[model samples]
Target chain A: MILPEKTIERLSKYRRVLINLNFQQKDYIYSHELANLIHITPEQVRRDMMLIGHSGTLRRGYEVKQLIEKINSIIDGNTVQYVTLVGVGNLGRAMLNYLKNKNKYLQIIACFDNDQDKINKMCCGIPCYSINEAEEQIKKLNINIAILTVPTNVANEVADILIKAGIKGLLNFTTMPLKVPSNVYLEEYDMITSLEKVAYFTQFIE
Target chain B: MILPEKTIERLSKYRRVLINLNFQQKDYIYSHELANLIHITPEQVRRDMMLIGHSGTLRRGYEVKQLIEKINSIIDGNTVQYVTLVGVGNLGRAMLNYLKNKNKYLQIIACFDNDQDKINKMCCGIPCYSINEAEEQIKKLNINIAILTVPTNVANEVADILIKAGIKGLLNFTTMPLKVPSNVYLEEYDMITSLEKVAYFTQFIE
Candidate 1:
């Protein structure tokens, strides 16, 4: 069954919190406790767990490891997903550094940039190719997902190139509104909008 | 009136889209058009507009300039908000570059880092200070919001210091779950979870 976008986002958050709990050696967690960690309501947590066909007794709560395995099967399955990063600027570099070996399922296999000096160089052990080579290299590497960090002016053009090159998913960091085919998936991560949201809430907090 | 967090986020997105429309010299936009640009339902856009006490006629839709003014009043008032960054690492630096002069109401006034070599230097025209001087500078500068981009291990400790230093809002970039006082507002921006969400949708897209 297809889940709502909001539900998928919450499931991802729950999985992260569960992994952290496992690392902390916490084997069991109540819905309310997990909700508190992620700043959501207990009922919301319970509803999400139910949607995924998982349940816990009111007394025992959830098993962290088992919940994680269930979520992994739903979100990632058995195969690992290979991702590529476009635009090796500051944001791109930061993402590469932060995500290096961080996840076993999702890995950034290669990167693309327009800078002549950066092309053919290795960033965080991931090969960097020129934007001109993005299409050829993406196909050769069998990359399915792309993280777009290009400037706003070039975002749409770069998105077009990636989509045409058979990119199934795009995690957009640029502010531009990109038009992709219905078959392609797009997720925009706008930092300024996010910060402004925080600012709005901070002012009206009761 | 206390608006829901989701409403605030949508408001932020609407404001951004309006700004882009204004840039394109578009005076009026229908809710459906705005929703199409942002990938949301028209009803959601109309609901957000209603929450902000703004409405449009069926003929002209919403006046782009008037809607922008209304949102500005709701999200940001007459005075600009002063923000500071806590880490000058790759993520922080990229954010600084992306946000420089982007918003007139919100400005990143200063930055803090523990790196001795980075202290006393300038990044994007913003002065960098040692983490030890964070409290002193934050208090003196009247900085209420902080962007925490430090490593996971040090995120909590630095957050504690910032909260004790009188920071009312935090835009956390680290992966660790931080516990702040009830009075303090916190927004966590985890890129990995966001990427995973994209991955999930890309795999399940029907």
Candidate 2:
């Protein structure tokens, strides 16, 4: 089943909500209640839930455990992805430290950057390589995913190199757009635009 | 004109691309070439450009200056947002220390954490506050946006208090989903998901 882009985005939010419920020892949840928690219409919650192949019984609502497993299966939790972080700047390095043993399902295996002083080193046990050695290292270590936090100027250049080295997807931290093949999945994150949205929407007529 | 969610996301990317181009002293850009750089169809880029009311001549493409002004206008460049980074963890504090401040558009107003020793202190002129005083201080300062880098466990509770105190948006760093009112916008970022996408598309299936 092909979920829409919007649906996939919501799955993470739903998964987080379920995790919170699990922590709270809540066993079941209803569409309306979950919707209220997420600030969406109850009908919308039901629709999102339906896409994951589960729903609440009128009285029983959605079983928290069952729903989590269902979402997990759809979300492919079994695979622990071998990931790499490039750039190792403040944002990239922070990401490197954050990913250190954070998730059981995905792990950062290596770090690469152009900074000569930081090159040929290790960040949190993940080896760091200079950009000159990136392709060789990525290919040698069999890294499939890359988190790009390089400056916007070099985003595409790094991405193209990664793609050439057989990277499957890119998580872009720079505010630049990347040119990748259709086979490649890309997610662009801009921290500034997010701050800007809050600023503009403060007294938004809409 | 209401663009698709996908397009709105792309605009941020385009603005970043244009900024980099401007920095490189590039004067003009063609839609096709720009599309080629970003891995999108020229037609799609042209359509998005149209949404911003920007026009580029056939060979000349779009005037870089003209396009940038239009983008800034559409994105509302009038208000400079002041962001509060809650929790001076690796992610939060690094962002405070590293992100370029010359722009002065999105300013880090203050930072808060649970540590007592760091309270009422300043990191780069931004005050640090105790978590106990967060709600009151947030309200007192009239902070409109918050960057949450606290632990996943306390993410929800902190965000709940923030929403109640009239926070309009959140740049969440924790791996938790925050339940907020409909009027509030929460951008949930998962570093692991960024890696998983690269793995699933690149290798797991094969």
Candidate 3:
């Protein structure tokens, strides 16, 4: 069953928190505690858990490891998903540094750039290929999801190339809102817009 | 008047696009054209414009420069909003790089970090101060909003310091979800959650 987009985002967050709790040797977490950590209502957490067909006992709450495994099974399925990065700029390298070796099921296998010096090198241990070779490299590496960190002027151009290369999902880092095919899933992480939103809210704080 | 959060985000986007169009010597934009550029429905764009109390002619559409000025007056008011960036690491540096000289109204005037090497230096032309100096520097700089790019382990600790120093809003980039006081506005930009969300959607793409 498909979950709402907001629900999917929250599940990913829940899994992150659960993995951390598991690392601390914590076995179970109450919906209230989890909700508090994520800054959401306890009722929202319970509803999400119910949506995923998980229930918690009043005594033990929810099993942390079991919930993580369930989320992994649902979100990631069985095999690892090969992903790619489309730019090797400072932002791109920062993303690679943060993402590399972080997840078992989602892996950034390759990166592409138009810069000659960066091409054919390893950025944060992932291979960097020339943008000219993106279509072939993406197909050969079986990459479906891509992280786009290119300049705004070339963002749509690069996105077009990625879509043409059969990329099904994109995480866009540029401020330019992109247009994609209906089948292609796009997530725009515009720092400027986010910053401005914060700026707007600051005015209300007395 | 306080606009919806989503509407504020869209206004910021419209302003960005309009600024570009104005720079290109374009004077007016129809709702459909603006919506197409931003990947939104024309009705939604028109509705937002209406909410902002702006109108356009059928023949000329909305005047680009006038709408931008109106958005600026509403979103930013008269004074520039000073912002502080904590954690001068890769992500922090990248943010400074992107935001410097980008906007006249929103300025990242300072950055804070625990690293001695990073402190007491200029990062992307902004002053880098020690975490020990966060409270003083923030207050002295009149910073009301902070962009947090610190490690997950210390995210909450640093957030407390920022809030205590009188920050009214926070844009969090760490993977750990943060809990802030009710008066504080928090925006979490979790790359892991976003990546995983894209990963989930990729499964449905044929």
Over B1-206, each residue of candidate 1 has an lDDT whose tens digit, in order, gives 97788887777778787776463388888999999877789999999888878999999899888888888888887568889988888888878887767778888999999999889999768999999998999999988889998977788899999998989889998876688998999988788877887788788654
Q: Candidate 3's residue-wise lDDT over B8-127, tens digit each?
A: 999999988777544437878899999988889999999998999999999988988888889999888867999988988877888778777777888888999989888898988898
The predicted structure with the larger TM-score, 1 or 3, is: 3
Docking class of 1: acceptable
Q: Estimate each model's TM-score.
A: 0.84, 0.81, 0.96
Question: lDDT for each of the candidates?
Answer: 0.85, 0.72, 0.89
TM-score for chain B in model 2: 0.86
lDDT (C-alpha) at residue B144 in model 1: 88
What proportion of the real contacts between chains A and B does each prediction keep? 0.54, 0.44, 0.70
Off by over 4 Å in 1: A1-74, B21-24, B30-32, B41-47, B55-62
Task: Point to the candidate with the largest DockQ.
Answer: 3
| Winner by lDDT | 3
- Candidate 2, residues B98-185: lDDT per residue as tens digits? 5436236666777888877778888656799887777788788877778888887888888887777667768786776566677886
TM-score of 3: 0.96
TM-score of chain B of 3: 0.95
What does chain B score (TM) in every candidate?
0.93, 0.86, 0.95
lDDT of 1 by residue, A1-206 (tens): 87888887787878876775453377678999988977789999999999999988778799888888888888887579889999988878888887767667888999999998889999878999999988998899888999998877788899999988889999998877678999999888788877887787778554
lDDT per residue as tens, model 2, A110-142: 888888878887865778888888788888887
Once superposed on the true structure, which residue ranges of model 3 sit more than 4 Å away at CA?
A21-24, B21-24
RMSD of 1: 3.5
The residue pairs that clash in candidate 1, if any, are: none
